[model samples]
Target: MALTLALAVNELGTNSVKYGALSNDVGTVEITWSLRPGAEGRGRELVWTWVERGGPPVSPPSRRGFGRFLIERVLAADFEGTVKLEYASAGLVCALVAPAPEDRAS
Candidate 1:
């Protein structure tokens, strides 16, 4: 799980450095996460969010790159989660929701 998250975040950071917020001095990226509780709080879900701001306008990539594939498929599969990418005109917002590993085995 750690490796998967590392790779996923690396992909996002790489993209930011290339064309997202980090491409410019005025831009910034905010990454946040929380655990959503389930019944008895025994089945919590991890929610990860990546938000870019003060950057050039955003648009869906013309193609689904390996990074996208990693987050959308690999990461999701590893954590049993779902990933959503929003390309609003303002910036890019990525949200990943997945079950906590320990909880998932229950």
Candidate 2:
């Protein structure tokens, strides 16, 4: 789980540096985490989004890259959550939903 989150952050950070909305220090990337209630506590999903003020609107990479592919594999294998990407006018939002470890054990 640590490794998965680390990679997620790394990928988001890299994208922010590359084609992110905060390109040139004009925008900022916002990241956050929270646990959802119900759903058998499988709501411990993670949301790592890159938000900025200036960018040519972005979309998820069509062909998965090595890093992204790895992230997807980890999320599905460990959390059983779906990794999703949304393009926003402000920037891009990436979300992953997974069942918590405890829930998976049962």
Candidate 3:
């Protein structure tokens, strides 16, 4: 799980450095995460958000790349979670939600 997250974040950072928000002087990337109790008193859920701002105009990718696959599919599968990628005019936003380890055990 740690490796998966590392690779995922690395890919995002790489993209930002090369083409996205972080590419420009004024652009920035913010990442936030939280752990909360699951619905109906289950274990816990992990929610993470990655937001980019002040970069070039955002648009959906014409093709899914390996980074996209890792972030959207592989991570989701690994955590039994859901991943959302949004291309706002201002920047790219990604949200990931997954069951915590204890929740999975339950």
Candidate 4:
């Protein structure tokens, strides 16, 4: 899980450095995660979010890039999770929902 998360973060950070919040000195990225109940209050899941702020205005990419592909498709497949990428005018927002590891379960 640590390696998985590291890879995801690396990808995200690279993108940010190139075009997102990190492109500027004043911009920032916020990352947060929590354990939450799964469907019907069954197993637990992890809700991870990455929100960029104080950056130049955002706009959706014209086409999918490999980095985006890995983040959306590869990461989702790896964790059996869902990854959402939102290009808001304020910044980019990425939300990832996945089954929490067994050790993290209640």
Best model number under lDDT:
3
Give the alpha carbon lDDT tens digit for every residue of 1-106 in model 4. 6776678899889988899899999999999999988977668988999999988899999999888898898888777889999999999999999888773432
Q: How well is each residue in 1-106 modelled by candidate 1, as lDDT tens digits? A: 8999899899999998898898999999999999888556668888899999988888898998888899889988888778888997778898988877677863
Better model by TM-score: candidate 1 vs candidate 2:
1
What is the Cα-based lDDT of residue 12 in candidate 4? 86
- lDDT (0 to 1) per candidate: 0.87, 0.65, 0.90, 0.87
Minimal lDDT window, size 10, model 4 = 97-106
Clashing pairs in 3: none
Write out the backbone clash pairs for model 1: none
lDDT, model 2: 0.65
Q: Candidate 2's error at 65, in angstroms?
A: 1.4
List the candidates' TM-scores in order: 0.90, 0.73, 0.92, 0.89
Better of 2 and 4 by lDDT: 4
Task: For residue 88, give model 2's deviation from the true position in Å.
Answer: 3.0
- Write one digit per residue (lDDT tens) for candidate 2, span 2-93: 77778777877777778886467576766666555536544454444334456657766677787677666775566667776666766777
> Which residue pairs collide, candidate 4?
none
